[model samples]
Target: MPIYKTIAHNSQTSVKIWKITESYEDLLKPLDLKPKNLTRVLGMKSELHQRGFLSIRHLLREFGYTDQDLFYDGNGKPHLKDGKHISITHSFTFSAVVVSEDFVGIDIEKQRDKIAVIAHKFVDYELDYLNKIAENYVNDLTKIWCVKESLYKMFATNGLSFKEHCLVIPFAKKEESTVAWIDYKDKKFRYNAQFLEFEGFTCAYTLPS
Candidate 1:
């Protein structure tokens, strides 16, 4: 499928999602991948990962970018040659990319019960409001995870702990947006978080507030 959804969050930032329904070959044929990216994709052992990687490149195309226009820093954060901020994520059968003139981060997660088992590792302040027995427990955890993951990507810094450094302000399941913070190095950074759910997957992204 081509661009399952596109969110024009504003004039300066946009999010694009791709549902990976095509074969690896079909995805590869149209992308003019950088040689290193081609090698990396070919080196991937899982077909699922290869498809996810290719699908992200397709998402870039939708944003008027090519593989040659993208690069990564020492921290492994993606950047565009034109100086725009970019974040990319893919899981299972879905992939997404967010690009903006300012810093931004995005993440998509497959809702799963297993996340509950390790929630303590990445969840902190959120525990105050989370009820493990609630019907939306797993889904809420997924949303929190996605939000923190985006914050992690946005910072692109080493030694950042999700539980210690990030917080997702309380939000009901029905709300599409929320507030979040990163309290690191004795300073705080704030972001406006937006999220959506479809096909048992939850996606969240953050932009500077």
Candidate 2:
């Protein structure tokens, strides 16, 4: 499908999402990265992950960046030589990137009923708020999952628990514009979180302050 979307909040920060529609081998030719690396680390056996990475690289190109401009920190966070903070995410057939002059993070997830089963592992105070909503709102649950995932990516650490550390205010069903915050290590970071439905997946991006 080669579907792509970009959101420029301002010149300092922007987000891009791409859906792969090309062959995996053809997609990896430009970057020349080892396909095995993604397969080994992400378990991306199908062509989805390969094309997703290609889409990510293409998005970087839109910003005048290339794979050479990309590097990873000790914590595995992608960094650009110009000192702009970056976060990358891929789920199934989609990949996303967010960049900013300051710290930033972005995450995309496939909305599924399975998230509800695992909600306890990453949802806490948010649960109480979610419970107040009617039981038939599956879309609401998906938004909560995306919000927490975005928060977790923003934190980008192992010790933080989404259930205990992340909190998202309830929004109307299928709401795409909302604000949320995360409290980590006694530091409170606020974010603007919004959701978009793309090919049965829910993508969320968080702008950190």
Candidate 3:
């Protein structure tokens, strides 16, 4: 029940983050989950993952939704039974959901120095402004990863490369918002992105621009 933060992005879109501090049993005790989802959670080997999954259901309830109202398509993108857009994400100690009236996506990632080691895999244009020696290098990389990840969730398709297809416009970390583009299959899509940091984690969410 620890909803760490909530962002009313606008009248039609909202973001909710939950800090996972409860045992899996305690988190599951108050809700009813669909059989398949229940099986999915129970089958997870990591207690952390199970708790994250259950805590998401709690978040859905906050948005007036139940587990039964959620489903995924063949693309593995989550959908609401009533036709709202939904995106979900979770890291080691946190989980979040973003629901909107338009195409939307969300992601949460823990800030870690190791992200620097893997930055080459998903970084391209942003490198023009990134300084590897800067004090906030890891923090910036983490935000870029979260933005690209949110783009991936919104454009749930095969063959989209984070480094090659997604581009984030330059912006200072203090700005907390930017524009991102997905150039795939010879077509371009635009989204407005916003992000924040809490407890050493970064959470980013996007909506079609």
Error of 3 at 207 (Å): 0.9
The true-structure Cα RMSD of candidate 2 reads 2.9
Off by over 4 Å in 3: none
Tell how far residue 58 is off in model 3, in angstroms.
0.4
lDDT of 2 by residue, 1-209 (tens): 44388888789988888777767766766664445554452466656665676777777877779877888777677899888888888888788888889677677777676767776776677666675346634556677777777777667788877777777877776467788887888998788887788787877777764
Lowest-sum lDDT 10-residue window in model 3: 1-10
Per-residue alpha-carbon lDDT of model 3 for 1-209, expressed as tens digits?
56889999999999999999998889999999999998999899999999989999999999999999999999999999999999999999899999999999999999999999999999999999998998999999999999999999999999999999999998885989999999998999999999999889999998889
TM-score of each: 0.99, 0.85, 0.98
lDDT of 1 at 34: 85
Candidate 1 clash total? 0
Top lDDT: which candidate number?
Answer: 1
TM-score of 1: 0.99
* Ranked candidates (TM-score, high to low): 1, 3, 2
* Superposition error at 40 for model 2 (Å): 7.2
Off by over 4 Å in 2: 1-3, 32-45, 131-136
Pairs that clash in candidate 1: none
